[model samples]
Target: MSDYKAFRVELKDKIAHVAINRPDKFNAMNADFWTEIVDIFRWVDETDEVRVVVLSGVGKHFSAGIDLGMLAAGTHKYGKDVGRNAELQRRVILKLQGSINAVDNCRKPVLAAIQGYCLGGGIDLITACDMRYATVDAQLSIREVDMGLAADIGTLQRLPRIIGDGLARELAYTARTINGEEARSIGLVNRTYADHDALQAGVLEIAQEIAGKSPIAVRGTKRMLDYMRDHSIDDGLEYIATWNAAMLQSEDLRIAMTAFMNKQKPEFAD
Candidate 1:
């Protein structure tokens, strides 16, 4: 709803298209990106009309990772006390983590449509999404090792879970770039498209299909999947049982059943 400096958001047919707007610098992440993303995703979470989100960049490349200038400026501020400086830097890291967590924690599914360069912090960003699709030539890397620092963002934690620990380690240790085909082979991205236009269209088609489903059912499904990640099989079953006890009573269920009997499409209210 509000204007954002780092992203351009458009909502239509219950799908939010959240695109990184800084194309000139290859859609690099700057100071505004870290802050505005939190605001944008929070809006996406609170807005009930939004059923799904398609995240992409408005450029030839997805992102070149954190802007080097911003990274340098952040390190320039230090106090005389070494412990105090460490505390300050720790807080900064936590703030950045919260930005990426916004996407991971959103109730609605966020699908990333990556193209070209998705390096360093870009890896952190996409790893947090519910699903990822990319152009065949999109180059993805865990680049912090080359920058003289380990990745402190969500990548190290989430990537291993997405692609398994062994391959995740190889990428992090070597800082090697992987194209879309290899990414799919490793299960990093769900699929690959021939080019940027096809990637956008394909991802948006998936988003639109998801948008047409019952919002309550979709949100419940996402909640269950997220819950299962840290919970045991027994716990997940119990949780879903409790969840459906209430959700199953919604009018959407009755509408869906009636539509099935009559051979008509069901329309759910926002």
Candidate 2:
């Protein structure tokens, strides 16, 4: 993967390891961040060589959310003209939301490994991932409320379905920070390690395991899970049946069954 101003990307053994690289600024989202993230996920979706992705941060923190300076500059472009300002703000919000949604919409499963502070937009980023793991000392917060604005990106929408309405509402209302343990307890993160080193190692192992699977089956499963989140049980069941009708015919199925009989690992093609 080419170098990005706001991220570090490394592709290995069908797994893409992507880390927010702006450590000096706590990896804060700036102008480059919004566009680069969208580009990265779009590339992931188009690359058949990649089967899974691991997202994390470099240095001390995951992210401190949007850079206050960047936020100010972007918003300041529209003056106090109520009509034009509102329309411009709406467009910017939609663009930001679309970038975050790309992570959720990617066909490959995304696992986020968070450490240090994951606040505001950072929380929005992780909630979009398929699974989240964090360092035990990490601090997470839904901090937009503290800034006098509701989270307009995705935390308000996706987080409620993640940790339930009561807990999600409490976080949004209070803007209180939660440690990794509390995050795990609330089902925000799947697991927590003692430190950043352990967090990265643990997440990489899981990513490797997922990357080893049949890409077709893995992608199909991710698609179904996303679909089921919005539909009823009956609808989900019918959708999966129709999905399998086409996907079950893949050569990977034969490779897997034959591997089982021979007690060998299955080698699947993209």
Candidate 3:
């Protein structure tokens, strides 16, 4: 894998740990962040060795969101023509959305380990993950309204589904910050730890547990859950029926069954 300017990626055992590396800048998302994340997640998607991903940040905060300097510089390039400027801006927003979608659409499940500040674009990033765990003191916010724009990335779309529309709307409109305890109460995060160390340990334990499962089964479960979001219950049932008809034939199933009968741990092939 290539060196990443915005992230530090390490694969150990079957888990891929992707950490935002810009601690000095509060792990702010710059131009490199937008492009490099897509590259990283793409690698994760294609690599059979990688069974799951744990996304976090180096240093005290998860991320303070997009770099203000980069945001301002992007706007400075707009031309005098109103129509052209709007079109250019629209493309930029779409590209940003695609970056977040990389995490959302990755075949393997992603678990976010959040601490400190998770605001603005950070909110977008974590919302895209399959599960989230945070430090009890982690400060999270839907901060786009304060910046004079709607969150154009995944937060506005995904947050509502995770936390429910009423609370999501309140957060977006108020641009208020909530601690991890409140986040857990509202189902924004699955669990909360007392500190960052405990948070990392807890999330890693979960990731390792998931990595021990059959990769094919885990991927298929994620696929089904994502499909269920935009589909009817009947559609989900039919889709999974069609899906398992083929997947049920994998050797992993036989191995799992045999292991169960013998009271042994099943080790699945990648």
Q: What lDDT does candidate 3 reach at residue 195?
A: 99
lDDT of 2 at 171: 97
Count of backbone clashes, every candidate in sequence: 0, 0, 0
User: What is the clash count of model 3?
Assistant: 0
- Angstrom error of the Cα, residue 24, model 1: value is 0.8
Q: What TM-score goes with each of the models?
A: 0.98, 0.98, 0.99
Each prediction's Cα lDDT score?
A: 0.95, 0.94, 0.96
Worst 10 residues of 3 by lDDT: 149-158
The positional error of residue 155 in candidate 3, measured at the CA in angstroms, is 1.0
From the highest lDDT down, the ranking of the candidates is 3, 1, 2
Instruction: Give the per-residue lDDT digits (tens) of candidate 2, residues 131-231.
Output: 99998899999999889999999999999999999999999999999999999999999999999999999999999898889999999999999998889
Q: Which one is best on TM-score?
A: 3
The segments of candidate 1 whose C-alpha lies over 4 angstroms from its true place after superposition are none
Residue 89 local lDDT, model 1: 95
List ranges where model 3 is wrong by over 4 Å.
none
